[model samples]
Target: MSELLAIAGLDCSYGEVQVLHGIGLALAKGEVLCLLGRNGAGKTTTLKAIMGLIPATAGSIRLNGRELTGLPAHEVPKAGVAYVPQGRRLFAEMTVAENIEIGLMARGKGKATRDMVLGLFPRLAERLNQRSGTLSGGEQQMLAMARALCLEPEVLLLDEPTEGLMPSMIEKIRETVSKLRGLGVSTILVEQRVEAVLAVADRVAFIENGRNRETMTAAALRADPAAVKRYVGVG
Candidate 1:
């Protein structure tokens, strides 16, 4: 596996108050790397920094060997990084089809592109005419991921994808992620569900007190329950 996304000595702050400290991680092509930690452990901030939602105060962020340190958030997607934020921020008033159209706008205007996205997420095919806000939580999450996929990203940054969903819904998300991995799309999953994270991740990185603590293969973390519980509040 080749390195696709790399963050070295990354740091970020909010108005002089630092939230991340010397955090670093890497994503390989076709791999799923999960970030595990309790709340306020700087998980979201790290994603934001990588996506350029918040500027990095120091260090480097690279995608596919291209330096992405100072790029703006909107430009990050063009560089092959798409972010599916925690809230599943879809346009409530927009129909599912219309919402997907908004996503197509990122890559370019093409009917084939629309077809590709709809094809990937067949569930969205059925709700094309329905308003996004009316969709269930799982469905909305699907829309969010589908919308980002329209950009045709090489790597996806997902934040707490299964946070507030039923077990069945979580299964759907897990299946979707697994399918994406098979298609050669690497992903960085920031999740609170330790079991699910370990189940889907190829590798795991633990972040604590705003810094990288330990990183290991998914198998190792699962085998050591005490290790998982120490940092992520789970075992």
Candidate 2:
């Protein structure tokens, strides 16, 4: 359970307005860590900062002990970090295969990479030539995840991936996260659903008002609903 990604005393801002203040969390190799907080708690900001989409004003972000604070956004994926942001940003005009190819380009990957990615998401396999915009919401999410997985990333940052999906689709995402963990892909998930997040997370970090409130094992959080109420007023 070595630390694969670490954030210490992290801070971020939007123009002159600060959003994150000394937020800290860590993810172990092959673990699923979920971030839980009320809206505007800077959970998404933490993920973006780690991806270098929004630069960290101060503090440390490291992957396998290599500093990532100053790295360019494009280089972040090359450093083995792939991000699936809140929106499923897809090229509406592109086909399913084309969308995945964009991710392959990140690592100079070829057909073998495509095959493996398709293997993980067989539904996508059936719609390779279909335009991404025409797919269902669940299908779009699969494509977004497939695109990120094409990078063969060690750390996957997922922002509210299950939002607005049906229960069955939600289960599909949960299963995919579990499957990825078995493959040694550590995930930092930003999710608000208490039951769903608890089901997949190895650990959970509570972020309140742009700072770390506490972090505990998922089992501990499940057994103690009061902690959720204290921080987010939800179970």
Candidate 3:
């Protein structure tokens, strides 16, 4: 499992307020690393810094040994890193197909890539012409993931992908994550749904006050229920 993404001495801030402090972690090829923490613990901030959505005051972000820090957010995807942000952020007025096309255009991809994503979320295939805003929450999430996949990224950054949804919808999102892992897509998953994310994650990192507090194998966390509860507040 070669390293796919690495962060060292990461520090980020919003204006005068600092968030992340010397955060560091490494993700391996085809591995799923879940970031577990309570709100304001800097989980989302970590993803933003990785994607260059926010400036990292100091640190290194590398993808496949290529430096990615200081790259603009739009260029991040071209470097084989795609972000599925917390809110899904789909174009409300655009049809499902149109939303996917946007991602294809960004990466200079074509119908082949689009078809591959649709294959992963067959529900999106059925609603290709439907407006994204009109779709259910789960459908929107599927579209979001599908759009991100259109880039054929080497590393996918997922921020609370299962935040607001019913049990069935949560299952669907989990299935998608599992499928991505099976397809050998490396991912950094920021999730509050402990069990669901753990099911697909190979490793887990706990964050507090914007610092990485602990990192261990997912199997180890699963084996020790007390650790899961203490770090993530769920088992």
lDDT of 2: 0.93
Instruction: State, as a TM-score between 0 and 1, how close model 3 is to the true structure.
Output: 0.97
Model 2 residue 181 lDDT score: 98
lDDT at residue 79 of model 2 (Cα atoms): 94
**Per-residue alpha-carbon lDDT of model 2 for 1-235, expressed as tens digits?**
6799989999999999999999888898899999988999999999999999998999999999999998999999999999999888999899999999999999888899899889989999999999999999999999999999999999999999999999999999999999999999999999998998889999999999899999999999978989988888775
What's the C-alpha lDDT at position 161 in model 3?
Answer: 85
Better of 1 and 2 by lDDT: 2
- What TM-score do all the candidates reach, one by one? 0.97, 0.98, 0.97
lDDT per residue for candidate 1 within 1-235, as digits (tens), equals: 5689989999999998999999999899889999988889999999999999999999999998899999978899988888999999999999999999998898785788788777777888999999999999999998999998888888998999998998998998898899889888999999988889877999999899899999999999868878788997755
lDDT (10s digit) by residue, model 3, range 30-87: 8899998878999999999988999999999999899999998889999999999989
Please list all clashing residue pairs in model 3, or write none if there are none.
none
TM-score of 2: 0.98
Candidate order (TM-score): 2, 1, 3
lDDT of 3 at 220: 87
Candidates' RMSD to native: 1.1, 0.8, 1.2
